[model samples]
Target: MTRSATARTRILNCTLTLSIILHAPLALAKTPVATGTGGAVATISEQASRSALAILDKGGNAIDAAVAAAATLGVTDPFSCGIGGGGFMVIYLAKDKRVITIDHRETAPAAFTPATFLENGKEIDFDTAVASGAAVGVPGTVRGWHEALERYGTMNFKQVLAPAIDVANQGFTVTDIFSRLTRENERKFQQFGTTSALYLRDGKALPAGTMLRNPGMAKAYREIAARGQRAFYTGPMARAIVDAVNRPPVAGGAGVRAGKMTLADLANYEARIRQPVASTYRGYALYGMPLPSSGGVTVAEALNILEGYDLKAMPRADAEHLYLEASRLAFADRNAYLADPEYVDAPVAGLLSKAFAAQRRTAIDPKRAAASVAAGDPYAYQEDQSIPLRPQARPLQKENAHTTHFTVSDKDGNVVSYTFTIESWGGSGIVVPGYGFLLNNEMTDFDFSGPRPNVPEAGKRPRSSMAPTIALKDGKPAFTIGSPGGSTIITTVLQTIVNHVDFGMPMDAAINAPRLSERNGAATSVEPGFAGSAQARALEAFGHTWEATPEEIGAANALVFNPDGTVTAVSEGRRHGVGSALVQRKGH
Candidate 1:
């Protein structure tokens, strides 16, 4: 069958049924309260949410509260994001109507060789390359957060870190989500003494509401507060990391080689600042991740193409079909032309253009899915950009279960959308000693081939699917949102934008609404809970396939502003998170 027909059948039959099973009805997502405003924050953790509120109550700006809350989250919600990982920060300064993207992404070790992962001219399995030190990238989250605080925040690092110190020193109730993930990965933790000691209590993961403490993490926070990034990257913390990483693992084990990452790699790493990939569709300006991340450009292209249709008028299933087809076209382009701008040429400017979007949209069939769409030659459109195309052998599909994210907005109109991950649970099962966390297995995200040919090239950033985005209407900030779910991140953010901008749903409604995803022209997966029988059946008629799970959509945190000046915040129920609004009391 053609890719389009297959997608139509799969969506109508298989994927549709699965979505209904996963998504709870929309009514379940409603909150009792209506629109409210003042200063509010939504994140993936409760204690951290409370901490942000405390900062607001204490006269700290949103940036201050965000930094404080972020520190607290690192200690309390270690399963998702922490100091050990690196991510981007999108800051919106309402005063100047400016949005800045701080790209503190992790880079490969200097000693990394392009052909390091190849075995006898064949590419290595994704997991094998990732579990090795070859996967470790220089972490930049701490410095990135600190930079935001220093530049725009009112509170000091010490003050903001206090909340985290309290949580780590005294401990907080272990929530259900925390306990569940820990238990699921207990065996990996058990294999590493330090890992087991930190997360597992008496050979079992901490139960919900169990008081858990992390004095080590707190101490590490203190060092950062006092000495800044240097303390963590090269000081005692560095020594501790080297010591832990250098420890040889048990024979026939997954422990990475000791000292595979040298101090030089840590010292040479530098976070970058690049322009946010941007495009306009139906008058709304869309901004997303740039080169080194396939998310921003690909999402822009998808949105641009979808703009041609009146999604609101179409049935949810038909709209979904259109989205899947457009996503497939975008992903095909992503697999072909998207790469690190620093290492490889990327036709970003050409790809996000209106003309390019129109051309790509022509390949889409509103009635059926296009099973296969070849990537267009970006050079054909942009003369200045060109890269020789080389096809690499396809590797096995490896499912990765690791990702975390949070969004923060200060009263001053400073906003940050941060996403990070360990690539998998307990990343490589190697603890960085005193750092109290596992290193990311991001290397697995790359296609390991040969020396410089789709290989593990040192300093080359991997393609990330993380899509933390901010939307603007006529050049004004309208919404800020992001999610965790690997490939699912892109679809979730796109839907939230549509839910708010196109459907006029409230912040909570948009975030809590059902989500679906299509990667590289493959099957479209919907959160079973969101689709009804009619929509599901329609999708099958369109030839899209589905995989049912407990929830079709992953967690998303968001903030939105209406024309009336009311601000609303939201977080999904599926996550161990809370969304709070501190709107001025009515008639106050």
Candidate 2:
């Protein structure tokens, strides 16, 4: 057969297999809320959810299911996450009753410096910086997956990777979001020969409903499945990745300078197991990702401030004002203190301290928003006074909207809340030749030209807004929650927890509730559902400016553990993603 004929046949066969797998009677039985005596999985992709459920059905634990689901997402939702990205995972181990956090965030190359993005004493153009090799960070997703599997998962890498490999090889139907994103990023993708070959066909973006096959991605997965983490970080794939990042920009393009990442950077990458930042609110313990990710500290600080108010007794308007007020304060601290702990002292202990939060809370006026909030002296509350406290510099905040989040839990009570990203949609818009994946532009998360703690530094992980969290009640996992919305991630997670604990809503309702986000900025953005409501009017009355943005507040997914041992899983349903709970088959 001709090469084109073979390609067509493969695509056809893959489509048939996908149809059978997705529409089979057993698969059809899976619902958004699957009540199984065994386990449940909630994620942003249907294929990913199914893959996770299959792992559960095969007697794999929650970690196994999460790894399986995350890998499948790399294949099905490549625009948001892939092996080339990095993330954080919060895992609850049932047997040991322990919660562990894995920090696989991408790091700046060894050659990076504070002035990497500055040219002639001015910051380079943001668009040019985003599309250039300088934006590429040493990817940590593959190492993170390996660490999770080795430490917590029961299945081997090969077993968990098979589903993703099959998905990439067989092909999947593209959704409207995918098609739209491709069109929006067509220029960036076309700037590179390799990216254009993968994302575009005949100089045109693929339309929705088309079968998108990525045999090259399948091969990459296969290699990893066979050789383990070394395949990606120390072998042929590593060389290919470095080569692509260092490749010259397309002729006449306004791309930034070539990357200086070395193969040593890839080989030295390790996913650290960090202590989760913990706090208590309304008798529940909230655990979130630590430094490098400002999520936990910020959430904890906000909740601590809110704990002073009787939210249920207060008028809804007053509660809304207080919520936004606390968010502003927490974000103020986040901007000042949060960064890669390896490069800066993040003052985690001071930031999450209830006493400090109480002190900060005193500045909030229930009747009106503050004119402007500034970072507090949380370090003053700490016993260790040796940590230098520097004057905080306000850095320009960049919006990164593309990322993926998933939650999984097994009947035995193991749970996983994972959020991963490539920094933005299509990432740096550069593809490793024949690798079939986009590399992360996570380096752009750093402050480009500022004296901020998060400014780029060699071997430093970029400050991330990806917050994966788990709430515990009475020392057991109560809920697993997270979202994707750049700076909005902190507020989204805060609101969801509030909706559940304070508003008395179920997991699904809490996730679906209207969201309002303010990141200590000039304007607060509200969803359409809340734009004209009494709450918005009240917030406006409080001297807060409202920006009615069409942007989705968050794409959050969560799993609530019922007292009766049943699990309720929910996907935000903001974007076109599906959620499911898995039940054990009679024969299985």
Against the reference, the lDDT scores of all candidates come to: 0.64, 0.76
lDDT of 2 by residue, 355-432 (tens): 999999999988888755778988877887787876563532655756677777776777788888887777887877
Q: Give the lowest summed-lDDT range of ten residues in model 2.
A: 12-21
Candidate 2 shows a clash count of 0
**Each model's backbone clash number:** 35, 0
Write down the TM-score for model 2: 0.92
Query: lDDT (0-100) at residue 224 of candidate 1?
Result: 82
> Could you give candidate 1's per-residue lDDT for residues 1-588 as a string of tens digits?
111222111111000000000001111223312234465556665567666766666777666776677677677667656776666666666677877777766676666666655568666554444444555666667777767777777778777888888888998888787898788767656766677778888768888988888888888888887887788789678766655554633224545543357777677667777778877767777677787766788788888888888998978778878887887777777776666778876777778876788898889888887676677655556666545654332321223434665666654566666666655655555566665656665655555643222245678776676776777886666777777666666777777777776677876777776666776535566665645566677788988776554243456777665677555566665543443333222111
Best by lDDT: 2
Q: Best candidate, TM-score-wise?
A: 2
Candidate 2: residue 578 Cα off by (Å): 5.3
